[model samples]
Target: MIAEHAVPTSVELLRLDADSPRTAEVRRKVVGLRLAPGQQRFSGEAAHTLPRADTDPNRVPFAVLYRQTPVGFGIIDQRGILDEITAAPAEAVLLRAFYLDPEWQGRGIGRTACLALDPLVRSVRPEANEVVLTVNEANPAAVRAYRSGGFTATGERYLGGDAGPQLVMRRPVPYEGGAGDG
Candidate 1:
């Protein structure tokens, strides 16, 4: 059961467009969360450490939401559609990466981020059967939150950490505005 809450939370998920001031703000939040290290293959190098602006056509279309115009930001990239997933092949979207400015985290902001991306995922690929994400076991709170969000363990580990092991989880995605069974 989803166990819908009695009231909606403060975070509001909005699509980020190149013209919006949010494009830059979201980049700050990405680094604030320390999601991608200073230099990464996907995120970019020192000079381009900031999240790729929406104008960068080569980069993936990242959907970012804010608490308001620019108070906080959370971003989700559809990973299964990317190069890494192509190397293995899968019919799922990777929540890829997510982060909220520390002050904004633990306020269900992460969950709200997932919830916000749900519709966006559906919009792009109605055939999307699920979403896959990897969380460090060291991050106990994160594992618990994702479990509560209907994700189940896949008995898989990746990029072992000194803190603890990692696991891959998947959540069945419901198709949008469509009637059919997978």
Candidate 2:
């Protein structure tokens, strides 16, 4: 179970829209994260990295909101990374550019946010049976966070990482019934 805190965490993933009025605010919040070398090379800019819905039918860009405030962002894709990684199963969805504000780092928000990704992806992309990501082995804190959130290291390392070698991680998404389950 997730830890209980004085401040309740309400996190939601909203699709990134290019023309929405809140787009600018969301971009500002996400870009302000200022990811470090390894993380920066992995995430890039959420705004620049997110593909247009039309451009890629299987990619979903999201703004990670905590208690109604923009604290981070990421993308859930049915293609791309997984194709390159090869270790993850065909039913996996690749999670990319996951970032939380520095101030919100140790508050359990990141853990909760990471845990939420599986359900979030399954909800939007039912074809995905798992969520996969690569965390730099050099960043032990991140490896720990992902593990705490239910992701397991695959023992398969990606050597093309920016700052150092990256360990491939995978979290199996449980099969939740779809619309006609009733």
Candidate 3:
């Protein structure tokens, strides 16, 4: 059972290690991650997604931590769906398998985690200039969260998703250094 907490906590994204003890704990927590019935159609459980990410060289898995506890999961795809489903620049990275545990939802953790993705993506894929994701048309809450986190719809709909049509959204990866800072 998930512990019930009333206050929103700090959110951070940490790269996961398939063999680490901390990751093992996270894996256990993932088994209990619950999504609403409607959400089940749009996002995948981390328990299933993480194993695939572990074997894919181009995919980087991240554990979303809130108050130092694992509360969500996400993956950064280097080039998996670029031309296959969506058209994006070569420097763009795909945000996949992103979802928070239902118990942790609505506390602004998702938006905070989304805002924290830029640095994490840059750390792993320095050449990435933008982050792109496809949200099912039925998932308005997710679209709103992504928008709040700085993504904008590209007016393109992807029909390849199994659930239904999806909107392609993207946001530029913010650069840390200013002009002449190199």
Candidate 4:
């Protein structure tokens, strides 16, 4: 089943089903989506390496959909957090390889998806409190998008990225309490 959550900008993040025809379509389109010279490091192809249920049972890949149409892709995984650029807390999730199709860029899909990730990730990683990602400093556009979507720089820099130095960013998950508040 493709799990989805309503988000702003009429975009929803759907859990990618590797065996589904939809996944193939997204993959085909991803091959043609070009990223800016500095943003190529965040290719959707890298997202494909994240473990799925059939592979590791702990990682998840998501397809960004605009009105039920696939427009982007990303992955959220807890693995390698301890060894990745930043030492995220045990309850923190690593948002990796987030990329929007070139055709869908500049339409706010990226920011909307970033904001909507809280609920989408909670569906599987309910304990996750903060989502972390490292963006190449060279990719100012991405850094701007993420910052606009509520992520803040963590003052941590990693020079291991192929594109150059990367800055660590973190966004705390919004609290969702059950029942009425008032």
Q: Which structure among the candidates has the greatest lDDT?
A: 3
TM-score on alpha carbons, each prediction: 0.62, 0.78, 0.87, 0.78
Per-model clash counts, in order, read 0, 0, 0, 0
lDDT of 2 at 165: 84
Total clashes in model 4, counting residue pairs 3 or more apart in sequence or in different chains: 0
Q: In order, what is each prediction's RMSD in angstroms?
A: 6.1, 4.5, 3.8, 5.9
Which candidate achieves the best TM-score against the true structure?
3
Q: What is the lDDT of candidate 2?
A: 0.71
| Per-residue alpha-carbon lDDT of candidate 2 for residues 1-182, written as tens digits (9 for 90 to 100) | 33444333687776664667787677667655555444665456555665453277777777778877877777787786687675545678888777776656666777778777756787667767778888887778888878877889877888876677889888877677543211
Clashes in predicted model 1: 0
**What digit string (tens of lDDT, one per residue) describes model 1 on residues 64-159?**
344353333333344433333222324466664444444444555566656555576665454566677777766666687677666778787765
- Scanning candidate 3 in windows of ten residues, the lowest lDDT window is 1-10
On the 0 to 100 scale, the lDDT of residue 52 in model 3 is 92
Clashing pairs in 4: none
Candidate 4 whole-model C-alpha lDDT, 0 to 1:
0.71
What is the overall TM-score of model 2 with all chains considered together? 0.78
Compare candidates 3 and 4 on lDDT and give the better one.
3
